[model samples]
Target: MSHEHRHQSHPRIVARLKRAEGHLNAVVAMIEAGRPCLDVAQQLQAVESAIRSAKQTLIHDHVDHCLDARNSEAEREELKAITRYL
Candidate 1:
């Protein structure tokens, strides 16, 4: 694949990831501050949800922008490999 591959969804995906990062940092702080376990767990779930959403969007963007009917077998394999992460 080309190193210069770009997708229209990339910017939004990045923003989502950055927000996830911030949430993850907050989760760590919550743990240190002795926050209630339920509160911490809920925040952790939110962080996980953010990251999962970003990953799904990124993978879909890749499939939309990078794959086609004429794609090679290797490309199809790559797609399958990425989907396994989900």
Candidate 2:
């Protein structure tokens, strides 16, 4: 896929990341405020999930658009790189 096509979902990905950032900030505040451990953990879990979702979105987009244009060897290398996220 062309650069333009590959970046089609960039805005969405950025939005997710921004949300995760905000969630992380909240987690920090929760810690400082002496919130319950359970509550802090829950917020941390949410932040982790948000980041994971963003990662999956990025990998999926790469597979759908960028990978199609790559050769077999390059695709294998790319897949290897993507696996680190898993």
Q: How many backbone clashes does candidate 2 have?
A: 0
Residue pairs that clash (backbone atoms under 3 angstroms), model 1: none
Q: Can you tell me which runs of candidate 2 are displaced by over 4 Å? A: 1-6, 69-76
After superposition on all C-alphas, the RMSD of every candidate to the true structure, in Å, is 1.7, 3.4
- Model 1 C-alpha lDDT per residue in residues 1-86, reported as the tens digit of each score: 44576788889989999998999999899999999999999999999998889888988888776579898887888878887776
Tell me model 2's lDDT, rounded to 2 decimals: 0.82
Candidate 1 runs further than 4 Å off: none
TM-scores of all predicted structures: 0.85, 0.78
Q: How would you encode candidate 2's per-residue C-alpha lDDT over 1-86 as one tens digit per residue?
A: 22234467788999999999999999999999999999999999999999999988888877665455445775667667877876
Error of 1 at 43 (Å): 0.4
**CA lDDT for candidate 1:** 0.86
